[model samples]
Target chain A: MLSKKQARAFFLGGTVVTFLIFIGLTIFSLSKGQDQTNHEGITEQVVRGKVLWEENNCMGCHTILGEGAYYAPELTKVLDRRGEGYVKAVLMSPVPWNPNGRQMVAYGFTKEEADDLIAFFDWIGGIDLNGFDTVVSPLAKDKIERQTKN
Target chain B: MKYKSQKVAYWFFAFSMLLLVLQITYGFIMGFARIGFDGLHEFIPFNTARAVHTNLLVVWLLSGFMGAAYYIIPEEAQRELVSVKWAYVQLISLAVVGVAAVIGYHFNWWEGRKFLEIPRQLDYLVVVNVLLFLGLILATLFKGKRKTTTALVLTMGLLFAALLYLPGMLPFDSQVTDSFFRWWVVHLWVEGVWELIMGGILSFLLIKLTGVDREVIEKWLYVIVGLTFLSGILGTGHHYYYIGVNNIWLIVGGIFSALEPLAFLAMALFAVNMYRKGEKKHPNKIALFWTLGSAIVSFVGAGLLGFAHTLPQTNLYTHGTLVTAMHGHLAFWGAYAMIVLAIISYALPNMTGRKLYDSSVGRAAFWMANVGMIGMTVAFGVAGVAQVYLERKFKMDFMEVQAEISIHFVVLILCATLFTVGIIMYIMDFIKHGKPTDEELDLESDL
Candidate 1:
């Protein structure tokens, strides 16, 4: 029979060992050499656009990088799927953009803000999402591939 | 109740219940919105509703955990809490922070991060409030006559939970990095330390209700929590698989995530075996139901359903779809929510000196809530599977897929209504117990 002391040791030892490994893995993955996150692409416009995204809580509705409320479309590949012009138009629209009857809160953003958001989308669209982009947004993938072929 | 200070737990439980009701209301709003009843869209948009719903779940569960600590720590330590006055202050501040966060969500004053959207300002207040809470709990435990394993584990869990919250507060310019650390708080708390808390509470409850030997229960408690951290710590990789992280997570997460169910399975088996071995069955049938239900349901909900989509291959499709929600709702309900409710059910009678332990109302509440929740899970699973097929596999338009699957939301709403009725009855039972009376202090031994 396992004693209480041994059980406690098992708990403590498992916790410490696994925690160290988790930390090591985190460091390894985030290191610059292993960087798939495209951290350098985050320009001033992209930062401001991210600020806008956060301020409006756009993630409440839309998912980016496959994380969100699942209420709205995933915006990770929005620039590829909709093109910059349509995205810009939607952002700058004075009224709620209800293209499919699901109303998006109308911010009526200035063109500069819209441009910044577009830049953010462009940056996000460029990241290597380990095939998630190709899987989730096949249409956008097709569009990008077609454009490259052109 | 063992001590006058334990009476303070009643107020915390009351506040937790209040927040739970509000959380369910926000849930209904989102559910209704899903099925095209977006009348509240102008006021409470889907995003706002979602933030409120998730944040409120976190708050209510935290409040309940605090209440459980307040109730259990004093008893396990065989002493009154260190400072009842400070405990109340902590409770009030927690409620204040919770209310402020919910109200802020409505006004769009949030950090826009899912689950961690309480804004940086309120996050500071939360830290202060939690620190005060830990100080009181730790002081009581250390100053007591004897230190029990249950008390230490519970305190450790609380302490670690507070420490984990700091990672979520760290700023990161890269969204991927931000998300990676966000799981450090959310995933670690739920899958790791929170299980310790759950184990502590379960050990306490089993000792009291099952008349089981404390040594036996505490031994298994250690084993259960050991299994939790062993698998759960590296299981954090499951979230990193496609989130712009290294492929290392795919292998690490897949193996660890598969092993994750073993913890819940151990938990369930431990609880059932303890019950069968128990010679003295305490009269608190409702609490027993919840305790046992929490173990079994969590195994099925958190363990099995989670495994259904945890693999990187499957998660590639179901990553952000309704499948995650399907697992999330049941997992939180079975694991955290039910445990909190079980402790409350067990403590209320002792605190208020009203032994409404085996009431029909309580029994009804138990069955209705469980059945309703299972129904809701099924609805979500069907919707999510259909979504994975039409949207991901078949490459249908997102909106088109939503329209096709909106019927599941209708089913979800119906099941949720039943679940709400169960909660309302439980509240009614709670009200019947009235307020905790200091006169009942140390009158009847907890066992």
Candidate 2:
């Protein structure tokens, strides 16, 4: 037996509160996340490589920061796993590495371009991402203990 | 068509149908490509096809929403539309912009953003076109005799949706920053404001088709709106969990998003209860079916299926998998797409002065589309679970995992065929309704 006036008031109040929560969480997350993603800071090469990555639509296949197609392997941690030289060789010739038809197109990058990409991968590799999956998240107990000590 | 200007909705609907055909064509191309049939790989690659398919689906839905607003506002406001000519102009501009963006995608002339791929330059055109649309609707509503809650909610949704698009357009050098604001548009629109639009349309159809008192239905509308905000606003956190965001979002997103289903569940119950309480005097059986179907199915698709992976635990392995595609197809179909079809089904006969309601084709369209979509959801769910296990859990190669799940896409294509057939029949019936007439303007309310 909800009356129209009651319904209106209820909706208006609930909406304002919900909006506040969303905004609060977004600001909090953005402050923490942006700091973490750029912790290593961007170099000229990293910036140029990011542009090249976008221009060639590298994200069309590989995910950087876990936000692209699932067709290919992740590139965010490539520098850690494959090293700079390995990344350079793969970019120079992608078919030998991913030749199962779902392969990267031949980008024909110059040496400087490959070096820039390597720098970009190196930058992202340092980002914690706080472990995008929950599997590697710092335990709640550890966080609580640290906060209490602080 | 209580107002002569309401005839403009016809063209918007016709345009939406045209885009729908193109959307399905792209869907078929991608579906075939999933199974090693890479005939169009050289020119229309999977990424390009995927972008075109998703973008067309979005535009068509927006066009449908705009049409619904044009048709509903004049009638609810009890006035002629402020400007019918401008509405036609808006439609043509929308089509031109859509075609330009689609063409640009082929030659790599667009932004690489997944859904927001219409290059920043064209985003300005979209903003201008939507402004014209909002101006007309707002002007007509203000000039009309009565301003109902139904009308206001729909208008608010459209206004907020337009405002939210600005955040996505802002330049950001950080990928995380770009994605953060992208969700402001994507997550907020679908989960937040769009629900308001759906509620308004559902309320209108329930009023007309169920013969319910307006007071009763609008009361439920308030509740649905309340619940939508209460849950859906925070529910955006579900996406924030694994996108290089704060770890706190994992807990917040899990709890709030899990509650998001309650809103859809409430809508389902509200529509069903209203139908039970009211006398069915309007006699548009097909429209009623779609109205009730959208309500119930949205709960299953957007609510139940969404909850399946909303928890951080499940989403850890399932994020961006076909599980998302599963929830996406169903939620869009059940919530937005079905509501558009319902409103069109309800409005067509009224506008054209026809009563072709209980035809075999219309009923078949309702059942086949629903069944086909449910089948597709099941297929995606199966494939998604398998992908999560094989790739995420076992560390298998991405290509090998995709190959193992290729068989499920076979099921997806078969069901998509049936869904396509149902849509074709719906278009046939739309054509059969012909065009709105001035003669029908003076007709009595069915209620």
Candidate 3:
């Protein structure tokens, strides 16, 4: 039988402990990695891609920058995982996948739009701050112009 | 047995049970979709099933609680229900509107969020809730008793619930305002108004079941209600943190929501203390199970996990993740569902002239439900962490992210299955083995 004063003390003590833990964890996370920048003016493309993603409700299935629907893959580091050409090819192939039995239908895009999408992916795939491997695929400098220009 | 108030209560319980069955079945289908999307996509898409599951859960819990209030208030006030016929009218109207809204949702008519998607199918659901609110107000007013603090808090809760719904229907230009108003309805109702209702009901149960002085229980009720408004209203800030809102919401939401659990923890302590100090041996030990279970689970579910994500920093990671779902499932069930069960256990015997149910089976069911809920919460927490790691940390392929975290998903499915089994067993125990005796009937009038 804890008295009222004791109960109050217990709650206050527990809250302080919890608060400290949250702060400590956050600081720990922040201190873990160094920042890296591969693209200078790619913010616009990433922003455009984000708008397009929401318009199409892509986040309803896919996640990007750690947000959105969980049904699809994370797109933040896709550029690191798949190069610019593969990204463009996947976007423009009109046949997303041809697995053993299941097939992913293509949302057909023009060549220019596909390249822009790849540029957007490339932008996201380049964020590597905090030692977190947010990069999805590594981008080659030659392909960067082609992807961005498209 | 012959009392009209008791009959009305039973009918309300029955209706609530109907909705509960539908909600759980939808939940199962939603789980199956997660596991085998290709197999079940056409029959019941994930979005549709999720909408139905969450909506039905809210409706059923509210219905059961409304029914419990009708039964508890009349007895506490020591008067016949002011308008028995009006009560029946309110019940039937709310039930009809709720069912119509749910049916509308099934047919692809929804506003698109989980608990807020009551569709234009029967916009009258809002009207019905207001009517129910009026019914409660009128009943309390005409009963010729001073408004107890508990009743006052409950009435305030209902009023807020009704008022909150209006903004949801407003035409807003900015999605931010829309989202804010939506949380005002959804988050405030559950974490704020609903807590008030729980405090009132739990106090009422404590007085009746423990033979504790109303003064003691009512004092506890006042404290709980105070914490509720103080912490809960401001606690809405937690939801605002990530939704493109101003940064000030970060501090306000984090601090207040963090403190919100204190009220729940206090309520748990109150219950335990009352049970310790209780002089009379409660006739139905199972009633105590419902009572204690409601307190402990609500504290753990709503208070603890709620604190975890209340901070802006944590919310950034946990928002929209499985962690949110885990918090919701346990908190809502603990606050509303278990409270309703507690009230039902206390009143059902009196209403039906039944003796107490088999205590052992009731106790077993309680443990089963509690264990399964804890399991589900753990599974979802683990899954949520994995999700953040894959999406935020590793930036893994989307499908591969899900596949990697499939183990947590499987654990959650099993936990839900276990929870459903426990609920079914409890329901069966109520119907088949509940106590039926005149002595139990006299116990209510003795108070």
Candidate 4:
């Protein structure tokens, strides 16, 4: 039963509200510091694992350093969170516990390959972006670098 | 031999229903996998099943729509289809190509894009769509009747759909450019062109069912089509925001995509208003269910949920998450699936001269489907929000977060199970109990 003017007014009001929400979120995101890491050089095993990662197209599901599909979790920080041993263990666990009793068939990796993957993950965990936000559009690469220097 | 148009429509409608059953089964299995990951590798892995579920949905809905267009276009033009044989050819080719594509997907041969994963073997599917589009255009033109606004809008929508792949086919070296064009296919098809098509078809069905003045329905159709293209084309900008695009895309995409919902809301209002004005007393309650249900659900699913994450700020958290899946499941169902169902309901009795076997049973199935869809949407939507919090805001250990949200997975499984049951009931009722009476056959002559 709204008149044309009333509908227009209602739409304008809604737009303003959405705009404000967007601005608030943008500001909040800018405030959060970028995550960084500090670690040592990669080994031969780690290098081999990196190649496997590409060949298998793991990035199709799992993101690393916020640069892949969101279907799976980020693996860049995996080593820091779970340590090398736990990483290998989870990789080798053919039947990980499913709380809802629905079966997830495990892709069982070889023991040596699992260790190499852990090493590669550990290498990725050590990259230091110096707390400049990395989740924004890749076009903001320069701005991120500037922020890091400041 | 007689009523060839109706016969073709019903046959394809039946095919669509069969595909719907398979898609729902896959949907349930995928839902269960979300809850428990123990038996994913059996025959249909999660990714494989998900691809099949989504692709089959697209195929079945499009087939039904093709059938509906063939049947309704001629009737609205007050002439027989210009070439019924051509229509049959189009259907046969589309079905053959569609089935081949689906089989390829089941065997894990895909193009790797989520919804665009039809294998190279079915690359000719687009050619088939183009042929059908041309057939429809020719039929409307040769009828010698002036094109109604509804027919014009539907034709334009089909034209856009045929041309949608242009950007995707551009020889772009950069992945980002390719991705941007991909959204042109995805976003424009669903948001822009599909909305117009749905508007046109909805108006046609409402007019036929309610015996309303064609002018009134056509006017509503015009407004909806205008809003659809105006809001939809620009709204593709929203998806461009995250994919290595400039910041201006954020503003353009966010603003326009946010406005896209208003057009859908307006369409819903128009339909309700028409129903109120019409003289027919619940002529076909099943058609009304689909018509009204589609309008309402599309507004909420495609429009609201689309706006929820249209902003670049929100997109950062919700992109590629289950939130996106929730939007997709409901939007496709509301916008495409329900419209096709409406067409089926409207045409079935006409084609068969059968009174719906049991009106109450059909109505009951409608409620069950609606309720089940709402339940699924709510469950998945909340789960998506929880996922955003766990992954983006809190940045918790990923596996721990997954373990905590296993309950949401269980809820999703339950909702999907309920939806599957409703689908089964509807299909059973349609097949076993749907027979028309002699009086209904006599009513067609009144047209």
lDDT per residue for candidate 1 within B150-205, as digits (tens), equals 99999999999999999999987788888999999999999898988888888889
Question: How close is every model to the real structure, measured as TM-score?
Answer: 0.99, 0.93, 0.77, 0.78
lDDT (Cα, tens digit) per residue for candidate 3, span A61-126? 444544443455556666655556776776677654533322233556678777667766665555
Cα lDDT tens digits for candidate 2, A42-98 = 788887877677666666656666666655666766664446787788788744354
True contacts kept of 4: 0.06
Residue B385 error for model 3, in Å?
Answer: 0.7
lDDT of 3 by residue, B144-263 (tens): 456665565566566667776776676443333445577767877888777877887888778766778777677666667667666777677777665434455677678889899998
lDDT per residue (tens digit) for residues B325-385 in model 2: 8999999999999999999888888889888888999999898888988999999999989
User: Recovered native contacts in candidate 2, as a fraction?
Assistant: 0.37
TM-score of chain B for predicted candidate 3: 0.93
Supply the global lDDT for candidate 2.
0.83
- Local distance difference test, each candidate: 0.92, 0.83, 0.66, 0.66
Considering TM-score, where higher is better, how would the candidates rank from best to worst? 1, 2, 4, 3
Number of backbone clashes in candidate 3: 23
Q: Write the per-residue lDDT of candidate 4 for residues B83-187, one digit (tens) a residue.
A: 666666777777787778767755656665546666544665666656675665566656635666666666667776777755555433333344556676887
Tell how far residue A24 is off in model 1, in angstroms.
Answer: 0.7
lDDT by residue for model 4 over A74-133, one digit each (tens)? 665665444577777767778742323433335577898887778777666555422212
Complex DockQ per candidate: 0.84, 0.31, 0.07, 0.09
lDDT of 4 at A52: 55
* 3 versus 4: better TM-score goes to: 4
Task: Write out the backbone clash pairs for model 2.
Answer: none
Best by DockQ: 1
Which structure is stronger by lDDT: 2 or 4? 2
